[model samples]
Target chain A: MTLCRYWRLDRHPEGNTRFERFLSLHEEACAPLAPGEVRIAVEWLSMDAGTRMWMSPRTDGYQPPLPLGSRMVGLVLGRVIESLDPAYPPGVRVRGFGQWADVATVVPALAGLEVVDETVADPRQHFGALGMNAWTALVGVREVAAVRPGEWLAVSAAAGATGSLACQIGRNLGARVVGIAGGAEKCRFLLDELGVDMAIDYRAEDVSARLSQVPGGVHAFFDNVGGPILDAVLGNMAHYGRVAICGMIAGYDSDVAMPGPAKFDQVLMRRLRIEGFFIPDFLERGAEFLPQLRTWLDEGRLAVRFDETQGLENVPAAYERMLTGRNIGKVIVRL
Target chain B: MTLCRYWRLDRHPEGNTRFERFLSLHEEACAPLAPGEVRIAVEWLSMDAGTRMWMSPRTDGYQPPLPLGSRMVGLVLGRVIESLDPAYPPGVRVRGFGQWADVATVVPALAGLEVVDETVADPRQHFGALGMNAWTALVGVREVAAVRPGEWLAVSAAAGATGSLACQIGRNLGARVVGIAGGAEKCRFLLDELGVDMAIDYRAEDVSARLSQVPGGVHAFFDNVGGPILDAVLGNMAHYGRVAICGMIAGYDSDVAMPGPAKFDQVLMRRLRIEGFFIPDFLERGAEFLPQLRTWLDEGRLAVRFDETQGLENVPAAYERMLTGRNIGKVIVRL
Candidate 1:
């Protein structure tokens, strides 16, 4: 019998909860794979702010309840242990929406399993810049907002995995990228390290005042950290602006009385369009997206970075760090 | 000098004001036409709920304030008495944005104005069925929502001009139309007279409870009375539903404290889209919309009705009556 470790919620903290190890997983934990299913030995797990929102009672259109004593829902890169489906075979590498655990058995119908190229530089890269966060960033901003080149693209939580990819995507698409992050370090990293045009340290600056510095109003806003930051961006949006509601990281940790209280007069005044998306909805387009994305990555037009924690033992810490903004770029727990 | 009585704001109301009338000149009051301008002899004036929103403080993007002692901005159907532009000639009947006065002058730039077809049924039909409100209903529900034929289309303020037109548009597009109006009388008018598929008297039925009675959740919502009615619609929107923010007639004349408090959580939860539109923005497409709309009107597939108040002197009283929901369709003042 194989042993698999997991971080399960012992009790939800009234304020915030830290991931703690509880009971270990045994082979019996997973029901036998029926036809069209595969057993996977998870190699890497991804952590994101979006997962935090799911940890609590979700007011948003998310999935079924996140169980109290279960591995967190996130992306995982793994090797197939056994297979009942023709699409995914034994020893093949695949990545998809999976539990943050050492081993996960999934149905091929629900899995985004694909044969990983043996020629790829690193396996970890699939869980980082080239994975779920990157895909979400590109699709959310491009498909949802339809942002054009030379237009202003503003992103919040700019140092996070999705935000970094969004900044680069905005730049590559010819948009003037502006990032908003919580601290000076993240702000500097966004501007200097990531090569973003401008960075607003939201903790240090009044977002509204900093927004006024942008001469032409923002054409599209990539909102990763919703709240007052979103309100500020709304005020400076140009007419016919689009707001891509990617995630609401800022208010995810805290049980805020309400989300943002800013009046939506700007929506009418600017004639803005707002849309929210969850990545799984675009899986069908991944075949179309991945090829173009791979070309960009190979040609140096796109970049992906990560803050990785080694071992499944550190998965809890990595998740905590992701929520606290202690990590820049993608947060992954490596096996 | 001919006497042309018109309603002027005697004093800006502190809260909600009653419209008061005064006598005015038919010709002397009009500013002389500059080059490429035309003067019109007013025949009929269109009244709408938006006028009250316009008269309020410019808190949001409702409308520009009406000049303290100027003629109220309205759409008037009149014959061109004089023309300084070649595009327009004397004796040509046209409809354009003009004052409530019996006589007015317009710039030639405003020529090529909406003209009433002498060959068509009624002159007032141009202002109601084919005018701003109808156009707003069309663009707001169709273009903004991108509504599908088999979807459920729910409209608030069902008896209003825009609301009724939206119901017909929904029917024309092959959707199941459900209307929410204040009273049984209006509901009957919607179901019996307008032939709307479903009509709900919001005052009699529990809106949220009743909305659930519709098979699937609402696909598109046309919100005219923005308040608890909107709250009910938002609560039940299906995933990716669209809300057309046509008018907030219920709260336009409200005191600051009485303003409608919207529950925006529903927006995020359902991944819904809400869009607001003004008629002028869609003017270029009028060439496409008008011909089709005219055909619909002529074929009896569409109906245009009005609450006509005789005499320009009664405009103020008409305005008060219009806001109070005593009038139906387009409220017009006959000269």
Candidate 2:
């Protein structure tokens, strides 16, 4: 019998609380799967700021909160240890929405797990730019907000996984890309590593002042942080601008209502548009994106950065670093 | 020379200044025009809440405040008394962006004034239902928000000119029309007169509670009054709802910054779309709305209402009544 551990939140806090009593890992013995089910031995787990949101009840139509004594729901790379389903046999690698635990039993359709294709150049690319992260960025840009090429695109949380991909994709489409991040290092990485045209360290520079550097104001804004940064983008948006609101990372961990100076007058006055999206929705359109993504990767047109953490025990620490903006690219825990 | 009287605001007020003190009407000789110009004897002037917006600095992209003592900029209907241009011969009636004066001069292109067409019905229809106000409503519904038939369509200031027309047009398109107003009288007008599905008197019942009675959340919202009412709409907006913001007459007169209760979270969570629009941009599509409007009017499918205030001297008092929501339908000052 193999011991599988699951991480669950004990209490929702007002701020980041990784080392605190909130997160606890409980161990259990692996059990046999039901008919037509498969047990995956988790290999890599994707850590995003959205993981913090599962701590509280979903404010809107999003999925319900993670139960107190249950494992956290997240994306993971894994191998099928045992399968009652013929399609996914033992030793086959796959990607799916799974728990932070080492082993999970799920039906093939519900898990959204796809058998890894060997023809793909880099299988790890499934967890990074050519995978879920890239799909999300593209969905936010194309489907949610419907951003057109040659427009000015501004993304908040610029150096992180989703933001980094959004910046590069905006550049690839001939758009002027501007990024906003917390620290100078992330901002520098956004400009130097990700090829973002302008990077604003919200901790250092005034967002509204540097907005003038864009000249025509932002035509499209990809927002990850949803407090003062969202408010600031509303002010600088051009007439008929579209804002792709991917996540409210800044407000996720907070137990209280996030407050910031706001001006909705600009929303009506400038005739702006804002929308939110999740990556899973892209699955319906996955066949369309996967081919283009593979081509972009093969042609060296796509670039991705990863801040990989080794071992399942270090997943908690990686979550902390990602929340604090310490990681440069996609934060992944390798088991 | 014909004497032309013009009303001007001598000084900008920091707060609500009584009309008796701030406004002054002075008479001057009707100046003759140069080539390609026509002299129009003003017949009626529109004195809606939009006039109050002209008192401040040009923040909303309208022209600068009327030069200290010059006439106000607004829509007025007039008859061509003298013509320096062949296009506008004497006795032809026209509409132009002229003002409080008895007579004004304009270039041929600016003289929107044409002989009132006698082909169909009531001449007053041209200024209210079959004119710019109706055209604006159609544009707000079809173009900006893109309201589909059988959708829930709600409008604020429902008995007013724009709102009243909006309800009829939305209903004509098979929408379930709901309206919000300040009193029972206007509420009655919305249902019995304008043919809306339901009407909510904000002074009587809870707006939020009444919205629950709506089968599903509204699909298209036509907002003229922006304040707490806008907040109420934001809370109950359907998934992927479209909010067409036409005017903020509710907050236009306030001197202090009236930022409607912060609800950016709703815009993101609900994937709601909010857009502001002007009729000028839709003029190209204006003619397209007229034939349909005329059909609705001729077939007795449309209702037209006006709050007519006679004489130029009553413009200030008439404006005061409009600001107070005393007028139901277009507030017109007849000469």
Candidate 3:
């Protein structure tokens, strides 16, 4: 038997996550693989804002709160060490929702684990550009918003994991993409690296004023950081615009309630369609999205950026940095 | 030459429209019907919240403010007394956007006039049940929300013009309907007259509390009156719910700024789709709607409720009452 190290939720988080207090590290003997089960040595864990939501005490939310004394829930890329299933042989790579642990026992039928194609060079890319982030961006821009060619698409948190992919996806769909990022460097990266038409430094300039300067105003908005930015975007939306609310990272850590968009009246005046979506809701559409994403990745049309931390122990610090907007792209903990 | 009396906007209204000062009665010699033109004797004028929006000084809106010193823009049902146009000959009835007047000289090509069928018994029904109100409710409930059968639907302003129609439409689509109205009388009307499953007197009871008691929560919402009620509905919406915003009459007359929905976070948590729409945007679908609406009317499956005023002179008072939620169903001024 091998000892497995994992983090368990000891208590519900208050305001900004006090990870050290709420989560306790524990070590236990890894159970031998049972019939149709695969034992995976976790390689990389994806740290997202959603993890923070699960840690909170709120009973009413998109996701159910993580039960206390249970292993914290997260997505992981792992390599199979032992397996009883013929489909997932030993040494095969897989990705699925698992515990924040060093070793995970996954039942092929019960666990939503799927084998990663051997042809895929980098599995981390699957976590960032070619995975859930890219999938969500595709659903928001293509399926929900139905972005038309020549339309102006504005993406908030444009340098973050999902937002960066959304910017590229917007451009890929023949839209004029405008990226809103925190600093000058991220803005430059969005314009030069991501091939966005315009990059606005939201920290330095007034977003609404910058949007007003655009020829026809924003026809679609892909929002990750909600609150004032959402209000700003609403004010500058063209007639019959669409807004896809993927995440609201700004208010995630705050104890006080976040105020709703002050310019919501614009929704009525401009006839805007604002939709909020979860990635899990569109999992079936992944079959439709993966081929296009892979093609873009192979052709160097899509770029993946990861802010990786060294060990599982450093995940809390990485998560804190991501929540504060210090991290540039996808936050990852490599084991 | 025949004398035609009409109302002209002399000034933009501030707060609740002071019709006596801003709108002045003007009498002028009616222009003779020229080639391609038709003369209409106005029969019924529609008074709506949109008229109040048009009267406001705000330049940034869905439609441009009614041109200063021009006749107040409204929808009117009229009979063509003299005509040079082949389509609109003398004795033919028509429906179109025209000024509040006893007689209107309309160029068939310039005026959006369509000849009304003589087979239709009640032309006033065209302004309410079969016209913009019902059309708006249809687009909101059917197309935007796509309310499925057995879904719980909540409608704001349940006794008002568009709201009452939306309640019936929700039921017609096989949805279990809940209504929000101002007073006990309106609530009673919604239950007894409109066949709503539940009615919440927003003036008395806590709307959010009442909604929480509902099993499975509300699946869709058709909103006409925005403000606190919108916030309340947002809090109680089930996962993947849709909200169709057809109107926001609550804030139409407020001198102060309107506060947005407080439970907007629920929009992201529940993954709700909130869309704002105008009826004219879906005018092309009128062909599909009119036939179904006419059949429903013929079979008495649909009911038309009009709060009819005696004369055009009382239009201002009728409009004031409508804006205050004192009038139920469609408010019409018979000329």
Candidate 4:
């Protein structure tokens, strides 16, 4: 029997600072695949902000809380090692919601497993340019926020996975992009790497003041961090502006509900719109989204900077880095 | 010269309770109509929650705040007494943004002036079933909130002008309507008069608790009173629910920005949509909407309960009565 080592939830975390105390690295024998089950040798684990909500004890989150002593679940980019499902046969490069384990087993249907294109030069593009983040960024910038050509699009948490992709997508669509991220380094990453029109260092600069300089105010906002950053964007939004909420990483650590934006009155005052969207809801439309994502990737337009942490044991550290915004791009654990 | 008696805004109001401290009644000779201007012998004044925001010194409101010492502006239904613009010929029953006066003058185009239909059985329907309130309700419920048939629709300030109309509109579309008002009398009015499926006395009963009784949670929320009531609704909203903000009378009295809803995170957690809309933005489409509104009115499906207060001298009292929720249905000053 193969040994499957994974991180397990010991308890619900209190905050971002002390994730180690609430999770422990554990090991188990890999069981034989059940009917319609697929086994994966998890090559890399994608650290996402939304799943952080599921780790909390809150029952009202997007999904149920992860039970104590359960294998920590996350998106894994890997090759199928063994499978009972004929549709997902052995040796196919796949991506889905899997455990933080070197060896992970999942029911293909429930885990949103999909066979990725193997002909791509870089297989990591499954977790990068052509992944869920790219899909989310496309849908958010193009459809939800409806960023039109020559419109000003503001993206919060702009140096991170989805936000960075969104910044590039906005620029690609001929919209002027303003990327809001913490620290001078992330701001530089947004400006130089993502080629955003404006980069606001949310930590050092006055975000609202910086945004106020944009003529006619921000027309479309793709938001990831949703606490004070959301309020900052709201107050500076143009009349009839659209806000697409992708993540609320600011309140991901806590079980308690996050307070809504302090400038919520702007919704009425400015005729603004705020819509919340999840990418998983659009999984069935992946084929439709993938071509555009691949075209951008092939043209070297969609650049993704991965902040990788080596080893399965480092998933918790990587997760903390992602949640705390210390990582400059997509935070991932290479198992 | 026609001596026009009107109310003047001397200073911004600190709160709703004491409008007398800020505004005072005054009389001036009605000025001759300028090029493109028209004068009205005001017969009635419509008190709306939105204009209350205009009474403050908020520079960033839906429009520039009414200048201090200027005439208090509101919707007026009357016969054109004089005109320089042929579009508003004398003796035509017209409706537009006119002053709170016995005689008022306006630049027809800027005032949203339109020669109203005189064939209706009750001319009050110009400020009632075929009025801005009806248009607001139709657009808000049908387009903004996008309430589908057989869905549950919750309306705040349900006994008031726009809210009462919205409740009936939702029911007319075959959606279940829950009316939330301040007291038992308003609750009874909502249930007995408006025929809402449920009526919650917001001052007595728990707004969120009453909303929780909805089977799949509130699918569409037409909110006028923002603040705790908005927060309550936000928390109990169904996944993919729509919130159409028509008014925020809760914060109308103060110039200070009102706090955003505390339960705002639900916007992300519930995948909900929140939109703010103004009726003036839709005035150009009034003719397109008049047919359905007229049909509903003729069928007795769209009933407007007028809480009428007579005389322009009592405009301050009537404004107070409307703002304080002391009146059920549309509040109007019949001159």
| Ten contiguous residues minimizing lDDT sum, candidate 4 chain B | B28-37
Residue-by-residue lDDT tens digits, candidate 4, B1-335? 68999999998888887688888999889777778889999999999888988888888789898889899999999999888998789999999999999998999888999998888998889999999999999999999999999999999999999999999999999999999999999999999999999999989999889889989999999999999999989988989999999998898877788888888888888899999999899999999999999999999999998989999989989999999999988899999
Candidate 3 lDDT over residue span A76-155, tens digit each = 88998888988888898988788889998777655668787768888898797678888988898887777899999999
> Candidate 1 vs candidate 4: which has greater TM-score?
4
Per-candidate TM-score against the hidden true structure? 0.92, 0.93, 0.95, 0.99
lDDT of each: 0.74, 0.77, 0.84, 0.91
How does model 3 score on DockQ?
0.67
Displacement of the residue B246 alpha carbon in candidate 3, Å? 0.3
| Candidate 3 colliding pairs, count | 0
Q: After superposing candidate 3, which stretches have Cα over 4 Å from the reference?
A: A15-18, A31-38, A83-86, A106-111, A255-257, B31-37, B82-84, B105-111, B255-257
Cα lDDT over the full model 2? 0.77
Write model 2 residue lDDT over A1-335, tens digit each, in one string.
76788776676645775534677788888776789998888888889777677777655435567777667778888899989999999999988888887886678888787887667766778887667888888878766656677788999888888888888888877888899988888888887877888899899999988886787889998888888888777778888788887887777776543543265556556666666666665676776888877777787767888899997778778888888888888999988
**Of models 3 and 4, which has the larger lDDT?**
4
- Ranking the candidates on TM-score from highest down gives 4, 3, 2, 1
Going through the candidates in order, their DockQ values are 0.36, 0.42, 0.67, 0.86
Candidate 1 stretches with Cα past 4 Å from truth are: A9-16, A19-32, A58-60, A68-70, A251-261, B1-5, B9-17, B21-28, B59-67, B108-112, B254-268
Clashing pairs in 1: none
**lDDT leaderboard ranking:** 4, 3, 2, 1
Cα lDDT tens digits for candidate 2, B1-335: 67888776775534433675767888888766787888888888876666666765546433345555556666778788999888778888777667776777777566454555666555677778777788878888777777898889889988888888889888888899999999999999898888899999999989977886788798889988878788777777887788888888765665433564455466656677777776765655656778888888888877877789888888878877777788899888888
